[model samples]
Target: MIPTKEEWIKVLNEKHGEDVQKKLSAATVAICGLGGLGSNIAVSLTRAGIGKLILIDFDRVDISNLQRQQYRMDQIGEYKTSALSENLTLINPYTELCVHTVRVTEDNMEELLREADIVCEAFDKAEAKAMLTNYVLENMPDKYLVAGSGMAGFDSANLVKTRRVTKRFYLCGDGVSDVNDNIGLVSSRVMLCAAHEAHAIIRIIAGKYEI
Candidate 1:
């Protein structure tokens, strides 16, 4: 059975301390893509008791996504925004979710992410990643951006590290590997990068930014 909201919050408080838990529960995070990295990052944040999430994605789950994404075989063909929201709700019922089954573009990004304290960029394409990163850094300077760079291939897991790019911009991954290199993405390594993004957001919420 699922625990009561109070019971869940109490456990989080015990683990995170009251102040940190409060901050985590009050923050809103926007995940720009709902694929491997975004889905895993969303799961981590939901499990950490984040208050709200704005899930944006324009793709449907495919059989190929089963290798690294969080979608189930039964969820194949479903829009990623919908599928991920369903999964995240199961992990933490108390976390509020606002999903958009649309692609994130410069025109809509500002309005979609206006309420988010942190924005995570998890697009699969380099062009898309650069677009979101440039838009957020130039337009949404106040919000923290955690982006994934190079989590593809069978590279050393230790190579996946998070770095603070600017005061509000942070990046995670090896900074070298790419799927186009034909190495492909491994589940464990991709999740490691996702974990870094999630942990960075949590640390930011806890008021610790010296990464």
Candidate 2:
């Protein structure tokens, strides 16, 4: 039988106090890219009792994504947001969710992010990240994106050394120039970035740090 919200609260409170649970249950977060970083972060957020999750990504799962993405082999070729939404429902049936298969851009930025409490920019494209940063800074000035940078190489791996940019936005993964401009990252480093991104996202959503 499904427990009531009170029961859920009791279970959560056993490990955490009312404040943390309240923060997790009241925030609405939008996760973009649904790839390595976004996928793991979504999973963490769902399990952590985030009241709502807005998953946005137009990409389909590939064999490559399965290694680091929070997806199974059966999810290949499926839209990422849909796959993750379904998984999240199983993880936390109490959590509300919104799924968007469209990519975030200047034209659609405001509409897509209007209701989001915070935005997670997990896309690997430099141009897209720059555009999103400008869009949020212009239209959604109060919001933030826990972005990733300098995560190109599998060798440039270190999760604990990641740094936050502003109170809201952060640059996880290696910040040095050693990150290859063209080399692709492996699962280890990608997941490392995803974990830090998830942590920053949690802290932001909890209102521990403002943008």
Candidate 3:
């Protein structure tokens, strides 16, 4: 049986101190692109008890996504925003979710992410990644952005590290590997990068910003 909301919050308070839990529980995060990286990042943040999540994606789950994404085989044709929200609700019923089944473009980016304290960029294409990164850095100056760079292939897991790009911009991944280089993405490595993004956001929420 699912735990009561009070019971769940108490557990999170024990794991994270009361002050930290309060901050985490008050933060809103927006995840752009619900693919391997975004899916895993959302799971981590939800499990950490984030208060609200804005999930944006324009794609449907495909059979190929099962290798690294968080969707189930039964959800293959479902829109990623819908599927991920369903899964996250099952994981943490207390977390509020606002999903948009539309692509995030230059025009709608700011409005969609306006309420988020942190924004995570997890798009698959290089152009898309650059587009979101540039838009966030240029337009949304106050929001913290955590982006994935090079999590493709089976490289040393240690290579997947998080770096603080600017005061509010951070990046996770190896900075070298690419899927177009003939090396495909491995589940473990991609998830590792996702974890970095998630952890960075948690640390930011908890007021720990060293790495």
Worst 10 residues of 2 by lDDT: 175-184
User: 57-146, model 3: which lDDT tens digit per residue?
Assistant: 999999999999999999999999999999999999999999998989999997899999999999999999999999999998889999
Model 1: per-residue lDDT, tens digit, 1-211? 9999999999999999999999999999999998889999999999999999999999999999999899999999999989998998888899999999888888999899999999999999999999999999999878999899999999899999999989999999999898999998899999999999999999998999998
Candidate 2 residue lDDT tens string, 1-211 = 7678788778876765788888888988888789887888898888788888888899998888887788989989888888888888777788899988997878887888888878888886778877887677666778877777655565645433456676556767676423346666677777777777777878876666642
Candidate 2 runs further than 4 Å off: 1-5, 176-182
Q: How high a TM-score does candidate 1 get? A: 0.98
lDDT at 79, model 2: 89
Given candidate 2, what's the lDDT at residue 118? 82
Clashing residue pairs, candidate 1? none
Q: Report the candidate with higher lDDT, 1 versus 3.
A: 3
- Once fitted onto the true fold, the runs of candidate 1 whose alpha carbons sit more than 4 angstroms away are none
TM-score, one value per model: 0.98, 0.88, 0.99
Residue 103's lDDT in candidate 1: 84
How are the candidates ranked when ordered by lDDT, highest leading? 3, 1, 2
Supply the global lDDT for candidate 3.
Answer: 0.95
